[model samples]
Target: MEARDKQVLRSLRLELGAEVLVEGLVLQYLYQEGILTENHVQEINAQTTGLRKTMLLLDILPSRGPKAFDTFLDSLQEFPWVREKLKKARKEAMTDLPAVASVRLPRELSLPAQL
Candidate 1:
């Protein structure tokens, strides 16, 4: 078998384990609890499958190694509000950008004429 396939099979062993499934399911339950705001919900919905996959990955990270443990430790230090935002981000990174403003872009994002 190809090296990548071997890695994938090895990873499947961990992610599908009972403890990983329980933790991932717990996170999903928390997400479905109606605590997240509308924008949060929309963003999550935008990448629903990817988010589910990441949450699964999170559960398997410990099996992956020390860098994974470091990431876990860092997560513990996140600011409360930042951590709240990241709970969603932990599952969906791209969909977690700051919300957009009115129809026009924010001035920080606006561009002057090419001239």
Candidate 2:
């Protein structure tokens, strides 16, 4: 396994799920490679931290030394288990409200009627 792959695999082993950082980057790269669907990216965007950090991770990866992440990603194309997990995670995320969604507007506060 590539080194980055090991880190990613280890994280999954520990949590039984994807690392937010790693998953985001993999999704971005796959999108760039034209292997991922736009709907999937949109769904991921609604659920994940915005793409900036994920982009940064991909941009900086060459400097982080070797990793197994590439191999794992390459294997995703044929890995039904990984794909099932990804779909399930996405399903769960779609139902999860954004952090800000819980902060409700004041019920009694009114906005000025006139502009």
Candidate 3:
């Protein structure tokens, strides 16, 4: 495979795993909180499936040029509110562990004992 194809596959693997896990967690929480109804869950599942179908179609295309690849990249848009909330949460979590920000280990200690 070409470099671009390898990079795209690596990114798709990472993103697909992360999206399914995170969305599953968020959906479960929302359901428990009574924020999402059964119908809402069904609708979200359908949407997620549609997205996967779209990605599969794109992946199976015979030839993809830069423009096609750029379009694919553009489709993976991040939700603004979700991104902001995650950023805020990460900042809060990091604030409680000030020493973690400057963590380091000696080279000898960083490696496994077997090495």
Candidate 1, RMSD to the unseen true structure: 15.6
Q: How close is every model to the real structure, measured as TM-score?
A: 0.22, 0.28, 0.28
Please report, in order, the local distance difference test score of every candidate based on alpha carbons. 0.40, 0.47, 0.44
TM-score for candidate 3:
0.28
Compare candidates 1 and 2 on TM-score and give the better one: 2
Q: Model 1, 2-114: lDDT tens per residue? A: 23323333444443332223222333443344333345434544544654644544434444433432343233332344334334434453354468676978888988868
In model 2, which runs have C-alpha deviations exceeding 4 angstroms?
A: 1-18, 22-24, 48-115
Candidate 1 matches the true fold with a TM-score of 0.22
Candidate with top lDDT is: 2
| Candidate 2 per-residue lDDT over residues 61-82, each given as its tens digit | 3333343245334535545566
Q: Give the 10-residue window scoring lowest on summed lDDT in candidate 1.
A: 18-27
**lDDT by residue for model 3 (1-115), tens:** 2334434444455444445422435444444444445665555566556456334433432144434333333333443443444344435554655463776899876978775
